[model samples]
Target: MMEFRSVQGSLIEAEAARNRARETRMRRALQRILTAAEGVPGYAPMNWSDVAEVAREALDADRPAGSNR
Candidate 1:
């Protein structure tokens, strides 16, 4: 039905918006992390594992106790 299509479209739009917002936040976080790292003596660029670990730490810090977020 037309109503179902409209609802589906709205959901798609919302998901796209969420994806965009998440990407922007990630970019900002990466920029900040790299900027800080640059100030450290003998700083090296992060490898994939290093990046993953950092991401996990950040998520854990932001996560509420007993919440899966």
Candidate 2:
């Protein structure tokens, strides 16, 4: 029951708020996964930086030499 120009705020502001909520949900789910993984048998914890570096190395190994990007 309102005119288009009478809307709450800019479209971008609404979209950004929506995106922030989605990211919060995603972070919660990811944290739950990590917590559960920590309790699994034979699970070992490492620094996130170490994990990230290892993941990057694995990706690099998967790629062919001289391949751009």
Candidate 3:
């Protein structure tokens, strides 16, 4: 049916948009890490695991308990 086709098309478009936004965020995060590490001594480039761990730590640090905002 035409209605079903329209819904499917919309879902596909939405998914594509989500994927693009995720990629943009990831690229920006990587750029930030690279910039932060630029002048540090004995520093090596990050791998995916390193990036994931750092991001997890950052997220955990930013969250506080007791009150929900």
Candidate 4:
């Protein structure tokens, strides 16, 4: 019915927003890695997983243990 259609539309919109946010994150992460490697010697390009892993490690290191989010 109409209610079902509304729900489906809302779900689609939410998914689109989520996709956009993910794309933005990926772009920003790539920019960070590229900027970091710009002047370094023997710099090699990395895949998304590699950059994400590096980012995650940095974030973890910055946070104090047993700290609540």
Q: Assess every candidate by TM-score.
A: 0.60, 0.44, 0.58, 0.59
Model 2 lowest lDDT segment of ten: 53-62
Q: Which stretches of candidate 1 lie over 4 Å from their true place?
A: 40-66
**Candidate 2 segments whose C-alpha is farther than 4 A from its true place:** 1-9, 40-69
Q: Give the candidate order by descending TM-score.
A: 1, 4, 3, 2
As for candidate 3, its clashing pairs are: none
- Deviation (Å) of 7 in candidate 4: 0.3
Question: For model 3, where is the 10-residue window of minimal lDDT?
Answer: 60-69
Ranking by lDDT: 1, 4, 3, 2
Candidate 1: C-alpha lDDT: 0.72
Clashing pairs in 1: none
Whose TM-score is higher: candidate 1's or candidate 3's? 1
Tell me the tens digit of each residue's lDDT in model 3 across 1-69: 999999999999998997786666666666657855684555566767877776665444434665453
CA error at residue 48 for candidate 4, angstroms: 12
- Residues 37-57, candidate 2, lDDT per residue (tens digit)? 587655555567755654455
RMSD of each: 5.6, 9.4, 7.6, 7.7
